[model samples]
Target: MDIHDHNRRAWDRAAAAGERWSAPVSPEVIAAARRGDWAIRLTPDRDVPREWFGDLAGARVLGLASGGGQQCPVLAAAGARVVSFDASEGQLARDREVAEREGLELELVRGDMADLGVFEDGGFDLVWHPVSNVFAPDVLPVWRECQRVLRPGGRLLAGFMSPAYYLFDFERAMATGECVAIHPAPYSDLHSLDAAAREKLVAAGELLEYGHSLEDQIGGQLRAGFRLEAFFDDHWSGGPEALDALMPTSHATLARKPEAAT
Candidate 1:
């Protein structure tokens, strides 16, 4: 089966069920954004620093694989020309629902993150991607696509799962038992995990995920024509505080596409 298609349907169902990531932002949040007092998250808990977004007025922003009605509406309200692209129809529908209710004008496109063919090269001033590339099997292609879509000197603010997040046995960790390392870094249910674990995910209709190394997560951007500017590690607050204190589970990066030779 095609991984992207399978994941797309899974996210569609997830959005229908009102999964946390699928929930739309409130009108009050939109109002706050319009007043220039808004923040968005690439990870749970902490808001992305506002300075990363220098100015939003008339900026062309692309929400890369970041849909479900949350960030896009705020960007629109903040005076950006926003385009929200996602792989799931249902997620895009949630963004559309918000746009209608909030009276925001933003375009919604559904496609693979690795191939942003619908967008012209150098068309976007910023590519705002949250922690979604874990759903893609190969991340380099996605980074390359982000570089291609962004105008020279444009910024890409992205969040992703840290490779270490997948090392622990999830069930054991959830049970408050000792968190044992059952898998290595660069994990994947489709290829790296045992057949039983893979079958479990398949049966549950859960989205398949890949654990990308820092090399691919960070180095990939460098290779894709992006210059790393800022980075931060973040913990998953929903989990046990001890686990969060032990180490960060996710990270966000700010990168810039180099301007054309003078």
Candidate 2:
């Protein structure tokens, strides 16, 4: 890898303390998160629709590097047997308390997402990959594992940043073709938060890994055996229309694993 890629990788691995990047979970995000949070702000309700219980009902889910029971609390409430894992002890502790208070049961584990040596193969039906897939150096390795752990026809629902979001990063660039790579977004990860906070994380050694293109995002899923089901161009979570056209920045796609091998 070149020096830029090497520097980016180092910076990315160092962003574990992603302070505020993963928003604190609450009731609204669980019931109809597509309509609730920052994720769906730029799109329509039907654009990125989902229900924790309806879609994940009876589905054994392994939230990949899931922090603070963010999606765990709701899925568990909805009757899905869910396992939450993360490398952060403090985050898991907070999740444990929430699980207990909510009368929900969540199996919380602390470890890395790259190595799930503790769990058996084909042990889960779903791997929730919201905003976390970019953490790995090469996402395919992780996607391959997600495929291994899933039963045939299982789904991997992942959310990532759209390319158009760069417009926000380069909001001022339109004025001058000078296109300053204003932010140090990691090569393939998405740092979706206010600019100031994003820079703060970067300064603390956090680098963003933005796939930067919808085609690349979908290609990863297809190569890993997931069939593209649907896609949304979300400007923000449950908000006004996203009229920015520079990079077509929106939540790009929704995909599922095919039941039959191609």
Candidate 3:
């Protein structure tokens, strides 16, 4: 099965079903952003730090694989020339709706994040990627594509799930009232789940997901030509499982492409 195509349809279904991520930002939010008051999420319930972003005024930014009208609209309102790229048509429509409603100028593109050939090399000054790479089967290619599309001295701000987040059996944890490590780290929807569980997950319109190691997430960025600048951690509410109470479930990083050698 084509994992990317499966995920695209699944997210479209989610968007149609009114998932929170599918909802567009309100006009009031755009107005506030235009007035220089704005923030966006890199992880659940946590806004990315203002310091992590470069100056947005007149910046050329790409909301990498980020659709659903959330971050790109805010960035556009904040004065960036923003382009939002995503795989799901429904998600892209949310961005377009927000742009038209708020009179924000944003370009929406549809494609896989791992293959950014639609955009030229060195096309963007900044790439803002949120917590969606877990949908990808392999993450190194995503990092490399992000590196390829960024200009010299460009910055990348990315949020991703911690590998440990996939270790727990969420259902078991809820039933037992303890975080039970039923799966090993570095899990994949394709390889980790038995046929029955995998079939059930797919039937529910849930995207297949994978847990990439920190080495592939962080070190892979370095390998793709980024200099790691800053990093932070975040946790989900303990609503799903007890894991969040013990450790962070998410991480974000700021990395920069170096200038050409003198």
| Candidate closer to the true structure by TM-score (higher is better), 2 or 3 | 3
Clashes of each: 0, 17, 0
lDDT of 1: 0.91
Q: What tens-digit string does per-residue lDDT give for candidate 2 at 81-113? A: 889876656556656765776667789987666
Model 1 agreement with the true structure over 1-262: per-residue lDDT tens digits: 6899989999999999998999999989999988988899998777999989878899999998998989999899999999999999999999999999989998999999999999899999999999999999999999999999999999999999889888888777778756678887788878777889889898888999999999999999999989999999888988755557778999999999999999
TM-score versus the correct structure, for each prediction: 0.97, 0.65, 0.97
| lDDT (Cα, tens digit) per residue for candidate 3, span 13-112 | 8888778889888888999999999989888868888988878889999998789978899999999999999999999999999999988899999999
For model 2 the TM-score comes to 0.65
| Off by more than 4 A, model 3 | 238-241
On lDDT, the candidate that comes out on top is: 1
Ranking by TM-score: 1, 3, 2
lDDT, residue 194, model 3: 89
Residue pairs in steric clash, candidate 1?
Answer: none
What is the TM-score of candidate 3? 0.97
